[model samples]
Target: MCGIVGYIGKREIKRQLIEGLRELEYRGYDSAGIAVMQNGKIQSFKAVGKLSNLDEKTKNFETEGPGVGIGHTRWATHGKPTELNAHPHMGEYSYVVHNGIIENYREIKAMLEADGVTFLSQTDTEVIVHLFEKEIERHSDLFSAFKATIDQLDGAYAVLLITQKAPDTIFFARKGSPMIIGRNRQGEVFFASSDAPLIGEAEEVAYMEDGTIGYATPDLIHSEPDALQFVSLSGDKLTAQKGGYRFFMEKEIYEQYQVMGDTMIGRVLDDDIVFEELGKTFLEGISRIKLCACGTSYHAALTSSYLFERQAKMPVNVEIASEFRYKEPLLTSDTLFIVISQSGETADTLEALKMAKKAGLKTLAICNVDNSSIVRLADATILTRAGIEKGVASTKAFATQVMVLWMLSIFFAKKRATLDNHTVKEELRFMSYVPKVLQKALDVHEKCKRLSKRYLHGHGFFFIGRDIFFPLALEGALKLKEISYLHAEGYPAGEMKHGPIALADAELFTIALMPKTLLYEKTKSNVEELSARDSTILSISPEMFELADDFILTHPHKHPMLEFFEMMVVEQLLAMEISIRLGNDVDMPRNLAKSVTVE
Candidate 1:
C-alpha cells in the first residue's frame, strides 16, 4: 500500500503537501515526492527515503502563486526503492501520483514504446501519465480524456493527476483502493488515501466510492451523482492525539483499559450477558460451532476455542480462513459458522463466509467496521466497537475481540445450564475488575523497557504457554515479528520437547507464560527444560519471581480469563518497547498492510 495527498488552493502548496505526507507516511515510506505548478509550468521533486528526505529536497522551492499539487509516499510495488522510481511521474501534459497496482501495465508500456513515447522510470505509474497524454490529444475536454484513460487500465488504483492545460484543477479516480476528498472553509480541496492527513486540515470530508471519477478546483467540483456529499472529519474515530506519549502504539497500549470498558458498555449487566444483535432463536439447533479467520484474528479465534469448549461445553472447530475454503468441509444445518475480522473486508474470510452461506448454514460475523461487506453478508453480526485501529500490528482490536468471545461463551454456558447462577455472578464480578488489572499492567512500562533491552541482540526468541494462554503466546510472537523483524516461535508447553526443544541454546531467549493456573506446574517444568539447555528465560508470572533468569511481575488474579487478559496487555507493551528500542517503526511495519483486501 502507498499514500497519496493532493491540494488545490491559494496557499503555499509545498508546505501543505509535505505536512500531509508526513501524516500519511504510515501507509508507505519507501520514497516520497511531489509535483506543483508554478508560473504556468509543472515542477516535480522526489527522494528515495522517508518523507524527511523529500521535505529537505523541497525546502528551497518557490510555491507562492495559486498553487496546486499532488504528492506520494510509495511502498515500492513494481520497482526497487530508488529516487527514479518515486512517484509524481511527469509526461508531456500531466504529472501523476498513484496508489495501487496496474495489472496490464506491461502491455500498455509495449504499445507506448512502439509509438515513440520514451519512458523515464521503472514504475507502472509512468504508464498512466503517458496514456493520459495520448487521450488528451484525441479528446477536447479534460474530463472526457481522463475517463478514457481510466477505461484502458486494469487493476486497483486511486490516481491523482494535474495537467499543464488545467493547472488549477486536480483530477482523480478510484476503483478498489481508498481515497477521501476533504474541503476546508476557504474553498480549498484536499485529497488523501485516508483521513489521517485531513484530520486537522479540513472540517468536511467525503469518501470516493468504487468506480468513481471526479475533479476539484478552487470554486467547484463535479463527479458521479451523490459522490460529493461530505461528512464531518471528526466522526468518533480513535485517531486522537498521543496524549504525552512518544508514539501512537504507546498511547494505544495504555488505551486497552478504556477499550475494555467501551466493549462491555451495555452488553455486560449485573448477572447475564445480552447480545441484542442476535435474537433468542439465533442459536437454535446449533450443535457445533466453526470459527474461521487469519493472522491476528485467527489467534483470537484459537483463544475462543478454549473458552467455548470448556465453559459452554460446545464442540468448537477453528480453521485458517485461507485453508478452510479449499477443503470440502462436511457441513450440516446444525453447523453455526462464525467469521472474525477487524476490517471486515479480509478477502479469505469473506470468501469463507460466502461458502458457508451457500451450504445452508447460518453465519455470524464479529467485526470492527459496521458496514463492511462481511458484516452485511452475514445473517447476524456483533460489532467489536474497538473504533479505528491505525497501527498495522493490531492492539485494541485483539483485546476487544477477546472480550466479545467471552460474552458469547457466557451466554452459551447459561443457555445450556453448563454454568450455574452463582458461577455466572462470580465470572461477571471478575470481568468487571479487568479494567483495573489492565491499568496495573500499564504501570509496568518502565520494567518492560528494562527487560526488553536485554533481548535486542538475541539470535532468536521462543514463547511457550498452556491452555488458553497458548494462543496469547502465539499473539506475542506474532506482534514481535511483525514490528521488530525478529525470528520468533510460539508453541504449546508440552510440545516443546517434541520439536522446538532442539533449537533451545544460549543464543535463544525463551519467554514463559506461567500464570499460576491449573497448568502452572506443567508450564514451569517446560521453563526448566529450556534452562537446562542454557537458554535465557524471562518468566512472566504473578508470584513465581525467582524461577527464571528474568521476571515480569504481574498482579495476582484467581480468575483465568482475567489473568490472560492482563498478560495480553503486557505482551503488547513488550513487543512495542522492544521495537522502539531497536529503532524500527512500531506503528507501521514493513511490507504489511492494515487491511488485506487484495489477498
Candidate 2:
C-alpha cells in the first residue's frame, strides 16, 4: 500500500504536504515525492527512501501564493524503489500521485508507447498522467479528460491529479482503495488516504466512496450531494501517540488492557451481551456462520471458530478471503457470512463480502474502521474500538476481535438455550475480570525481554499449541516473522510428528503454549518429543516444565479463556522485544503496510 495526500488551500503547499505524508508514514513506503502548482506551473521534488529524505529535499525550495499540490509515499509494486519510480509522475501536462495497483497498466503503457509518448519512469502510475495528457488532447475540459482517463483504467486506485490547465483545482478518484476529503473553517480543502492526517487539521470530513470521481478547490469540493456524507470532527482526536513507549507495537501491546475494556463497555451489561448494531432479529434465521478474512484477521477468525462451535454449539466454516471468491464457494440462505478486517478496506475480504451479499446471505462485519468499505457493504457491523493501530504488525486489533467474538459466542448460546442462565452469568462475570488479567500478563515483559536475547540467533522458530491455542500459536509465529524478519511456522502440537519434527534441532527454537486448563499434559508430551530432538524449548504455562530450557509462568485461572488472553500478551511482548533487540523497525516493518487495500 502507498499513501497519498493533496491540498487545495491558501497555505504554503510544500510544508503542508510533507507533514501530511509524515502522518501516513505508518502505511509503509520506500520512496516519496510531491508536485505543487506554483506560478501557473507544476514544480516537483522527488526523493528515494523515507519521508525524512523528501523533507530534506524540499527544505530549501520556496513557493508563494495560494497553491494546490499532491504528495505520495510509495511502496514499490510496479517497479523498484528509486527516484525515477517514485510518485508525482509527470506527463506533458499533468502531475499525478497514486496508490493501489493498475492491473491493465501494461496494455495502456504499450498503447501510449506506440503513440510516440516518451515515458520517464517505470511505474504504472506514470500511465495515468500520460493517459490524461492524451485525453486532454481529445477534450479541452480538464475534469472531462480526467474522467475519461479513469474510465479506461482497471483495478484498485486512489489517484490525485493536478494540471497547469486548472492550477487551483485537484482532481481525484477512488476505486478499491480509501480516500478522505476534509475542509477547515477557512474553506481550505485537504485529501489523505486516511483520517490520521486530517483529524486535527480539518473541522469536518467525508470518506470518498468507491467509484467516486470528484474535484476540490479552495472554495468548495465538487461531488454529487448524495455521494458525500460529511461528519463533524469536533470531538474526535487522533489516538496514535506512543505516549512513553519506544514503539507503537509496544504501546499497543500494553494498551490491550484498556482497549479490551473499551470493546466490551456498552456490549456487556448486567450479565447480558447486547449488540445494538445487530437488530433484535439479527440471528433469527442464521444456522451456520462462514467467517472470511485475510492475514491477522484470518487468525482471529480461526480463534473465534472454536468458541462459536463449542460455546454456542453453532457450525462454523473459516475461509481465507483471498481464496474464497476464486473457488466459487457455495452460499446458503441460513449461513451468516462474517468478514473481519482491521482497516475494513482489505480488498479480498471486501470482495468476498460482496459475493456473499450477491448470494443473498446475511452479512456482518467485524472491523476497527467505522465507515470503511466492508462496514458499509455489510448488513451490520461491530466496531473493534482499538483506536488507531499505527503498527504494521497488529496487536490490539486481534485482542479486541477475539474479545468481541467470545462475547458473541456466549450471546448465541444464551439465546439458543444451549447454556443455562447460571452458566451464562458465570461466563459474563469472568469476562469482567479480563482487563485485570491482561494487566497481570504485562508483568512478564522483563522476562520476555531477557528471553529474546537468547532467541536472536536461532535457525528458525516453531510456535506450537493445541486446540484453541493452535490459532494463538499461528498469531505468535506471524508476529515474530512480520517484525523480526525471521523464518517461523506455527503447527498443531500433535501434527509435529507427522513431518515437521525432522526440522527440530538444537538451533531451532520451539515456543510452546501449554495452558493448564485444556490438553496441557498432551501438549507437554509433544514439547518433550521436540526436546528429545535437541530443539531449544521455551515453554509458557501456569506450571513450570522441568524439560524446558526457559519458562515464563502464567497464573493459573479457572477458565481456559483467561489463560488464552494471558498467553496472548506473552506472545505479543516476546515478538516485539525480539524485533526491538534486533534493531528492526517494529512499527513499520519491511514489505508490510498497516492496511492492505490492494490484492
lDDT of 1 by residue, 1-599 (tens): 47899998888999889988887754435688999986568989999877778878988886776868999988655665788889999998689999766767889999999999999998888999999999988998999999999999986789999999886899999986678899988888999987777887888988898888988888988877455778887732235244346677777778777667656755676898877688889889997899999999999999999999988999999999999989988888898899999999999999999999999999999888655799889998887766557788998889989889988999889988899999988888888888788888887789889888888986888988999989999999999999999998888988999988999888898989989865888888888988999988988898764648888888888898888988898888899889999999888899999999875
Give model 1's TM-score versus the native structure. 0.62
lDDT of all the models against the reference? Answer: 0.85, 0.88
Instruction: Give the winner by lDDT.
Output: 2
Root-mean-square deviation of candidate 1: 16.8
Return the TM-score for each candidate structure: 0.62, 0.62
The clash numbers for all candidates, in the given order, read: 0, 0
CA error at residue 320 for candidate 1, angstroms: 0.4
Candidate 2 collision pairs: none
Q: Candidate 1 clashing pairs?
A: none
lDDT of 2: 0.88
